[model samples]
Target: MSQANPPGRPLLASALGGLGLLAGMVLIAEGGRRLPPDPPSIAPAQGADHLKAASHAPLHDARPGRSARKVAADLIAPPPLDPSGIERTEPRPPLGELGLAPRPKTPMPRDWRETLLFRPVATSSAVFEAMGRTVAISGTVDIDPDRTCTFDNTDWSCGQRARAAFNAWLRGRALKCFLPPDADRFAIAAPCALGKQDVGAWLVSNGWAMAAPTGIYGKAEMAARNARMGIFGPPQ
Candidate 1:
């Protein structure tokens, strides 16, 4: 057998191997210590965090992947339009002026012939100058053309003088008349005045007309008859 390795040399070699292994382990540990700590892994928001972010975000931002311009346009209100798609006046009045004023009067026609034509509707009623206008003698009975009054053994047509005078008066004036309560556009009102005189009462009191059967002016008619005025004159 070869001479055994020198015992001292073998023992020294074994010790050197163990020491080298130990040194290598120490170096590895030191290298690990010198390295920076790995950065903490960041987890994306989930559940409550995600919901909280959504709540706090701008309204337009909540939508996924929309561009800023598109977001802005979506957030804006649409232009107002009617269902029929036609442009029209605003239904609501402007805040500045609320209550409306009266409308302007309608202008009349320039030509007299184009103006409203009036005619007699009855013995005591006439449609006056304007269209759709009329006047009634409030309390007088119309003179009956068929009725006769005796005076001096001759018969005179009833109240012919009164009729003639009334026609003459109307021919001279420009008429502006008014309507009374419960009266229509064509109704002759009782208080109708022609130049400050009540035509009906004047006619009756002057014995040129008779009181209505309803007796609105019976006392006056009776007085004229008793005085033998007008057609009541005794057979002359």
Candidate 2:
């Protein structure tokens, strides 16, 4: 028979093995604590690229990686140029170049009815000269300078006497006459006044001149006729 192994020897060997296993476990735990945690897992660039590509894809195509930069550029491009051509218009010619005469100005109606001042020379019982124009007193009948009147069945030159009397009253005084701007140079029927005295009124009132059929001196003429004054009276 073999000699029996020592129990103490076997037990001591098993204790040594247990101590080695414990030391190995402790070393592993300490190493794990000392080491920096595994670096955070890096995200792959493909994930970001996939998102970017998806955003750029067209909605209708459903494809995930197609770029729309060229389509977007075309959508934002400027409009096409206009096709119509510019037309030039001709300028109008001046009146002088066109040989056209200038239109004459028309006088205002108010100006034609204005009153005029003139120094007059008595020409007869109802006519006078002013501004180199002969004017007859309106509203009165002019008596011829050679006219005659009969009183007591005797004829007398009443027209000459009336003219003389009118000249004496005038004494070369200035007169205000209402004459149209286009009055004729000859005997124009203008109503005239000396100071505040109406020449026609004086003539009709004194019976030196006869009142016109449509004149305002009818009352004065009647008074002169009833009084037998001037031509209605005896020659003076």
Instruction: State the weakest 10-residue window (summed lDDT) of model 2.
Output: 100-109
Error of 2 at 93 (Å): 74
Question: Compared with the true structure, what per-residue lDDT tens digits does model 1 show for residues 6-98?
Answer: 769988999999999998899898874665689875457566786788899886665778655645664596867688888678688756524
Q: lDDT of all predictions, in order shown?
A: 0.58, 0.81
- Candidate 2's C-alpha runs over 4 A off are 1-109, 113-117
In angstroms, give how far residue 175 of model 2 lies from its true place.
0.6
Model 1 — which ten-residue stretch has the worst lDDT? 108-117
Per-candidate TM vs. native? 0.38, 0.51
The true-versus-predicted C-alpha distance at residue 11 of model 1, in Å, is 99
What lDDT tens digits, residue by residue, belong to model 2 across residues 84-162? 7656689667667347554454334465564655667777889988777788998899888889999899899999999
